[model samples]
Target: MGKKSRKNVFTPEQLLSSLMDNIPDHIYFKDAQSRFIRTNRAQARFLGLAKPEDAIGKTDHDFFAHADEALADEQNILRSGKPLVGKIERVRYGKGPIVSVSTTKAPITDSTGKAIGIVGITRDINDRMLEEERLKSAQEELENTVRTIDMELNIARNIQESMLPERLDQIDEVKVAALYIPCSTIGGDLYDVIQIDEDRIALLILDVMGHGIPAALIAAMAKVSFTKHIARGLKPRTVLREVNDELIAHLKNERFLTVFLGIVDKARKEFVFARASHPPALLLRKRRRTVVRLSGKGIFIGFAPRYKYEEERVPLESGDIILLYTDGLVECRNKGGVFYGLKRLERLLLKHRDAPVDELVKRIREAHVEFMGDVPPSDDIAVLIATLE
Candidate 1:
């Protein structure tokens, strides 16, 4: 005898029944009027029925609060002969709690290819929908918080800029020009030129240890202290000592500041300057075509209490230029990791030695920008140029 065929182990009806009852998703068939012809165990339990047979001959209106919309969707599927796939729906069953479901409905066609009814499968998606809604709400709140912070930062930037001098006044026999750029909305670099007496003027530039809000606050405090000491007719060294004491008292060695202060006296035709761990000032002699580094020894402010600062005196002549700047100018790097060192800046000054103070400042800035190319400076930059007539 021939071996029994595997296909004969179960009839088609038995296989269909097994599949419909085993799956967890709701599966059902509806007639043209949208009344249920048959339902699986899952669908019957979903409709609060004790058995699948009890769901027969019942319409969705008997068990669903929004049955009219479901009926319209099924009727459209039966008429269009097209399948509706993966549609998310919110439904209430017999006044029970609402639920989210992903549903697919297809037209059940006859041998003639005419749609006679609709076959549908639905899966519960209530938990997934709730999670997505919660995530969306959180994202909106985060975006709102970011916007508020940005607005406040802009306001802070404006206030910091306002603290700087609008323009440096030209004292007797001296002309001045300055430029400032911050790596961010606010920075730790500051510069000021103040008239000390009829024949003397004070110039100051300072750099805090870092960038952003903390550094900027320190810079502001240093500025206020420097100005107060200068107003009392203190010498360059005395002014630095007072400012250092003030900073040490407040910061307690938590931060540091580099400062260069100069007093230009027309009567003596000399520039008296002091340093606090700052870069040396450059003096460009137009007639001799020489650049001199006015170096002095001092410790950084806020590092120690009562740190004594020393002064250096350099003679000034007609057509002489004094360049004061923060380290950010020389420390700026290019894409090749090459620094725009002091040698390059000295060469630039020599090249523009004959240019006016304002023109020279402009040229130096342009050269720095060109050297950077697409690279951005990592710190704040400030330059002050004083020319003697």
Candidate 2:
């Protein structure tokens, strides 16, 4: 057998010294008086010391930025013999930037189980803390941006609603009732019942061809233009003709609207109306209990430069009801994609023919809600009910 050499074993102190020198984390031992008795190379480098021995015999109060707090924590662990595990600390040393550290401190016990000194290990967490702070700032900024947008939309909604006339009730010898519901914060539908003189009133209802902010803006422009024409004493057809020309001049990108303009002559007992590619107004006769659709051939406003609208005059008697609405009211869809058609609308009007204008509008709206169930409307719905009193 070959001669076997005796294997050398490292001494306990030598093994500990090797671990303290090689470990990446800062390691230190403090005496009972809180003086640094010994420290690893890593701890010395963290404190900007030339060598480990340079930190020996110095207390934490001499080097740490927040020394009083650090000393109090060390004293507590030494007196209670309780380990401080994973305590995060913020500190700066020797003019260096502030850093975050995860520190664990424990009592150094003698062989007899008596506490002698304090030993600690610290890991740098500056990079992780910095990243977390950045994320928190970004989240706060995003929330502020969302809040600002919500406020702007609310103001826009209020302005859009203000453009329509006040709730109609018995305007100029005619019983009037109306309802408006926008699918979003703003809508494209608009209506006005303007008293032109003591003997006549104009009822104008229009639907711009979309929803939201863009549609709302267009509707407002159309409302101003129509009001200007009315103030100029223009006829129903003349007013529509002027409005169509103005829209065609100003609007582009396929923007368009359908309009119905009607004038109720209380003295003449007649209703003269013009349609610009709009849904027909329903006429309910109380005596005959029959509904007649008042419709004519026309095109949508803002689509062409030169357009002519046909005006039709229907004789009106007391107790005759005229219902004007946007297509959203009749074309409302259910979950199964079925439309609340004109037939259903006419039947509802006949059912509530004798009811007051307000009650009639309410019941019809309720019937529509019941038909739709939980399905949301795809567009804005507006209705104007007029009874020749």
Candidate 3:
């Protein structure tokens, strides 16, 4: 057999040199006097030296613009024989621009436990610092945007409240009471009591589909429609038809509203009302001690142009109470996901039938709040009660 080839084994110095050459961090050794004793390939490259030996015997002052600070830190490490870990600093390499770095420096000891030199490893952190600054800027921008939106919403709420009537007091023809609560800063609910000539008064309540700014804008349009028709002395059915047509003309999207319009003719002692996919109005009769639900056949407004609406007429008597409301009053949900249905509302009204109109409204509101418990309302609520004197 041919002579066996001798195995090649790397010496410890060769192994150590290879490890320093392969690592990406700048590695160097400094004597107790702060003069460079040795350097790795990465450190030599940073110092613009052709090889590691080229950095031998050089101090930081030979290459760094701010060497005094680094020299003082190295002196402290020598005196205490302690390590400085992950110290962030800025330094210029050769003629390059200043860059951020995280550096760790440890003291080296001899056989007698006396400190001989220091070993330092520095990792570049320029990209990490830039990313942190960008995130901070984005967070500040988001906060400013949220504050501006909140201020604008407050202004919108004030304007919407100003458009609604504060109190529906007892008038010459009929006594009226009402309550309105919006789920947010603004609502999509609107109501009005307009005098249609001397003998007739128009009672109107409308609910747009959604909440917030878009729905509030639609409610504003409904207000304009109601005011225009009532001033023209239009009948309930005719007013709904006209408003439906106007809304269809104004909207280009799928937005719609449910409306209940009633004309109270004091001279004839009659209540003529029309509904457009809205919840039925309730009439409480004191003489019979019963309730009558006023409902009619019609589609939602702004859905189909020229939609025909049917009008319902009910004869009025002394001590008669008419309640008109949005679906929110009846559709309120509790914590158990149960709705405060119309049946509960009817029972409450009958229980407080003899109470004054204002007192009756307050009692109903209280009952609703109690039924809801800790749950919040999911929609806007509005109600109007008219007592025929």
Candidate 4:
């Protein structure tokens, strides 16, 4: 009973004072007239005061006197009758920037419920505020990068679309349609149709050999160069020859172009085609499929100074149409990492040979979506199809 009484001897107020003295934060008390009354050990240590006895009657402003800091602090204590928490302010130490602190001051009340002195606690928060500011700046920078990228992609898409012939306009006895999808903001797929003469229609599908904006830019350049060459009266293979040399001179070691150029003569029912290390076009004749996988025997242009390409003529029947494409369509991968490869495409073409060209395109795209199983297409997919007589 005596030992228990000894433990209970310290009152709640005595325990609270012990807590204030031991805590790492600064704690102090001021009288009704804003005169220093009591201060804890923690308060003296924080203020660089040598001893708590020395700090008891000395106000912090008089002891730490850097400026009118004491007057401002006393004014704040007087205005807030209740506890005022988390007021941030900078206090100077020696040199450099004065770090900031979060301060709380509560009015002390006597037994009659009248306010007397004030109890104040202060916590330093300079590091946290600086870290928050750094994070905000990083977020702003990231947002700016995203906006710039979106703008560039929109500009590239507009330029690419403008280069396309407004409409294929049902050729004399030919039905043609094209589709191009870029997997990224910008990519390396191109397809176009040109009216060469009343009887001849020129068609081309080109793939710049890479990815991203650089690849897309190169494809646009090829469109300009190819169109200019043809307008100057150069033939398909001859234009390809000049393009090959020019591309080699322009592109660095890592880039090249795979292009298929063809002219269809409606009156003669003839097709003259040239392939430049490109994947061959697929000829869907009624119920049969032939992959002209044999591109002309030459290096992929831009890999060397000169590469020869040969042109071949084939008599296209009234019911036959050809499909030209980039590898992205067949090379698209699934969640299991399996490619929708050449074998799969060959089977689908044969099965869907009787369907309308647009239907075939739509269905194949849908099938690719299902096969990929929530994964995006990994590259650009470009397709061009023309029915000939």
Best by lDDT: 1
Candidate 2 lDDT over residue span 236-340, tens digit each: 888888898888877773789999988888899999998999999999998899999999767888987778778889999999999999999999899988999
- Which candidate, 1 or 2, has the higher lDDT? 1
Q: After superposing candidate 3 on the true structure, give the runs of residues whose Cα lies further than 4 Å from its correct spot.
A: 1-27, 33-35, 38-85, 89-100, 106-117
Which 10-residue window in model 4 sums to the lowest lDDT?
287-296
TM-score leaderboard ranking = 1, 3, 4, 2
Candidate 4 lDDT over residue span 19-134, tens digit each:
98788787788887666677778777666667766666665556444437655655665665566778787776433357777888888877976677788887878888889779
Query: Which candidate do you rate higher for lDDT, 1 or 4?
Result: 1
Instruction: Give the runs in model 2 whose Cα sits over 4 Å from its true position.
Output: 1-64, 82-89, 93-96, 102-115, 119-124, 167-173, 182-184, 208-218, 231-233, 244-258, 265-270, 275-280, 285-320, 327-344, 369-380
In candidate 1, stretches whose alpha carbon ends up further than 4 angstroms from where it belongs are 1-25, 37-64, 92-99, 126-131, 247-255
Cα lDDT, model 3, residue 76? 89
* Candidate 3 local lDDT, 1-389, one digit each (tens): 23443333667788889989999899999998888888999889989999999889999999988789988888888889899999999899778989889999999999988888899998888999888879989989999998877776776676667668876524476878888877755667888888766677788899888666677788888899889987898778899999998889776556889999998777898899999999999999978889999988899998999988999999999888899999999998899989999989889888888988889999989998999988888787999888788
Better of 3 and 4 by TM-score: 3
What value does the lDDT take at residue 300 in candidate 1? 94
Worst 10 residues of 1 by lDDT: 1-10
Top model number, TM-score = 1
lDDT of 3 at 291: 90
lDDT of 1 by residue, 151-170 (tens): 76676566567668888856
For model 1, what is the error of residue 21's alpha carbon versus the real structure, in angstroms, after optimal superposition? Answer: 5.9
Tell me each candidate's RMSD, in Å, in order.
3.5, 5.4, 4.7, 3.9
Total clashing residue pairs per candidate? 0, 0, 0, 0
lDDT of 3 at 388: 80
